[model samples]
Target: MSFNNGGYLETDDALRMLDLLSQASGSDFYMSLESKGKKVAGEIQTLFSDNMEVLEIGGYSYVAEVASAPGSGKGVARGLPLAVVRDCDAATASIASLLYSQDSDLIVNILVFKAGGDNADRQPFFEIELTGGRVSQHAILTGGMPKRPCEIIVFSYRAVEIKSAPQLVSGIRGAVRSAKLVNN
Candidate 1:
């Protein structure tokens, strides 16, 4: 659908469009995209290029512009554990705050990826990656009332372009979440 006459998307319309896109492409596609903390510019042009309806949407240009901007996907280090939280809610809030913060780092997004190898027996290990935060130093993940140090493990990094989105979702997520921690 096209934007309103003002050339802007309303919240409801935007949400609806996202719902349609997610439904059409499947949650697994979005989950994979979200997991890797990557933007959908590539997919829009490649995966959905054949769909005339999707191509007609005017918002794709903005997505591509944002993705190609300097320091767009370059600033935030992937898979850097900032701190430990009491629960998942706290973690979500922390990530949101960082994304909304006005720091020079301009954090665009935050993502969590599995750090454990293909071992179901291992605990559900994961790490955080910041998309556009200017982290100058490495920080440890500490939390709780008394506060204790959490062990840091080797994380995965996406060294090459993933050719198959469906086949390499898990591998991509794992790799995208493997960057060393950095702090401002």
Candidate 2:
């Protein structure tokens, strides 16, 4: 698909993309968007099906701006910052792998978000000491939060010329955090 920088996808197209990712990876897909004191699931499917506006980031990531209002439905809302749905798995892994293969200064941040409490209450939970590139042995836990844990990993490489490593990491982190789940 010819994805514009900020183009929005219809629900059917989004669902199709999710289906393709699931088939390719052999796993079901889910977007975590909290609402009404709980994580909303099928609402994402419903919103997409209804052609709600979703922001496309870097072709692989998408963010749906959900309204915080209770009865507010249909098209995208104007002012309120409602909820966010992100494709927090396969696409992230692909990005990390691609960055890892390219350069040595590449730093990959794996952000694990568990269910239960709000995003704010969940602060810098813990960090793992990695001596090498592989993270296969680590079991990331978040103080027994929700059963449905979602991970959003971002990769950044230090610039050889102008930008510093911290700058690059910060920019990448901001971008990744802003991105909501659409498809893998």
Candidate 3:
């Protein structure tokens, strides 16, 4: 599903989350935004056009575009959206369980979200895309909003070749571990 305010994240938080994704995937990132028709989405849409230019933060680049609303439901999405409960330790445990349940070598696309303060299912979050066993793309909504999506940040990574359950577990563990550090 498209992220809600409970899943929202600020620009700085999104970038910090990117650090975790980078650590887990062992790569930098190519970042962009996909407008989901929210208020901030409009601000972003007005800032850039299809043929203008992209902005660079730290070292990575970001491009923005206006788009239709993302489809509904969890599976309407193509990636796995992970919300950490209690702490990253809990997240790691859940990731382990999820990997073990899967039965094949797969390319995992995880959208790690930091839930909203009141609840974990709101909005205002960023997303990442993983393909070909590396972090290739990231989607984020950023502006000077009054509140952030969550204390934890979303971890976006690309196609991690989980050849075995152990590898899958380790990759996600690393991502969660990095998130723990970032969260604290």
Candidate 4:
């Protein structure tokens, strides 16, 4: 159940662990982190224009970019949409590409911060859980997440959904297809 001499789980090992955990089929959930700060908005736009593989999760779309320096706790991010897409429940949708750190180890969590209310640390709109350790913890849910935009000012995110994994890849694929327009 290890990849290298470090004994860290590799693809094969990870799968084996999942098989044992009975959570093989992961969930495809996401966090919509919202922000109106000029600095945050500008950064998201710049990052999106730079990336080629735009990760379209459901009605949401995002691109991952790296933070300029180390220990910044900041990184590439997403911006609010100019218009609403069908099936996109929330009005203000922003995904945050955050650089996380645990025990001096760096990690990343791309979340979707929704809009509404006035609290900044309110509950989430969705929960995205990953069996593999990416965004801390095993399950993330939206039970306690508040329905406000200001509640998500910063602090990146942490999924609360109780699922194996958020199937965002497939969801992104669907989003891309839905984005396709007809030449009238």
Candidate 5:
């Protein structure tokens, strides 16, 4: 469906659309794109059916798990977290907050992608950050296409058993890619 004359989908309409997508996908795709926290994490875990603890901080959610130590017999704790904010501005702020809350020695690497505009062919704006020690990664992407008004942020704590950050990002991309409109 096209946006209203305002060139944007109304909040209610967006929420309704999210609900429909969530129901159809049986994943928290809607919540992952709407809210930012445990709700999103819970929805994501549903897709993989991997049991993990959900943790929330500063409007972001994470999947906490234990991973095997590289070449070791022990296990290490990690987190797979995500945040879905409204826009790029919010995403930036969220990133800043996340940095402040973490250790000062943390090193963050951010990469952004924005080529197309608002057209259907436009690629969603995307940013990915790998935190220090490769312990965690944070990613943010514009909802794009049918849900152009929102941004999705995802986090992946590198764990041996858990999916990598890029892999988790691909899952979110898959959810958005599968969205379709049907005429009644």
Candidate 6:
């Protein structure tokens, strides 16, 4: 699902997501789009594109437009696409979650998104992936735990809240595992 608004990668309502993902270093931000509609879950695979010099954001993939030709997608225009995971594997998501959920004071942008393709009757499950927006290093929380597509929330990290961060992430992992087990 793509929006028509040009240039603005983030909507006004994206403050929560921005703080949660872009400025995620110390805050728990909840995402609630202003209007009626379903929010699209971003996948890591789409964030980090392959070494093709081409960039992919959302469902759109673009590269540098020729200098002589008309304006297609360049500098800021490219960045207009929301920052999200461009590419990822199983371990990627695990490591991302751990990294984002880590106990720290310095804030960083950590994008944890799921692949929006789970069917209702097929045991709802989501695949978490790391979207390296502004953050550099990342870790894994529930490396071996399973994730439920329907039960995932994006939040920010706070200074004092860093204490129970590990346990909190563990709980999320446990819950994901439990859901997987129940589904099976």
Error of 2 at 168 (Å): 31
**Candidate 3: lDDT of 183?**
10
Residues 71-165, candidate 1: write the lDDT tens digits. Answer: 57654432332221111222333333333443333222221223323322221123223334332211224343223332111112322121211
Query: What are the models' TM-scores?
Result: 0.25, 0.20, 0.19, 0.18, 0.24, 0.16
lDDT of 3: 0.27
Between prediction 3 and prediction 5, which has the larger TM-score? 5
Taken over the whole model, the C-alpha lDDT of each candidate is 0.26, 0.26, 0.27, 0.25, 0.30, 0.24
Q: Show the colliding residue pairs in model 2.
A: 11-48, 85-180, 85-181, 86-180, 86-181, 87-181, 115-146
Worst 10 residues of 4 by lDDT: 175-184
Question: Model 5, 57-110: lDDT tens per residue?
Answer: 122223344678589887655544433333334335544355445432232222
Question: Top lDDT: which candidate number?
Answer: 5
Please write out the lDDT profile of model 2 over residues 1-184, one tens digit for every residue. 2123564333333333332222223112232222123322222222222232222211123223444567756644222111122344334443334334543332222222222322232321211111112211111122222223223222112211111121121122111222222211
Evaluated against the true structure, the overall lDDT of model 4 is 0.25
Candidate 3 lDDT, 79-100, residue by residue in tens: 3433221112223333333234
User: Per-residue lDDT for 19 in model 4?
Assistant: 25
Instruction: Choose 3 or 4, whichever is better by lDDT.
Output: 3
Could you tell me which 10 consecutive residues in candidate 2 have the lowest summed lDDT? 158-167
Evaluated with TM-score, which candidate comes out highest? Answer: 1
Give RMSD to native, each candidate.
17.6, 21.0, 19.7, 20.0, 18.3, 19.9
For model 1, the superposed segments whose C-alpha errors exceed 4 Å read 1-9, 18-62, 65-91, 103-184
In angstroms, give how far residue 140 of model 1 lies from its true place: 30
- Model 4 bad stretches (over 4 Å): 1-7, 16-28, 31-184
Better of 1 and 3 by lDDT: 3
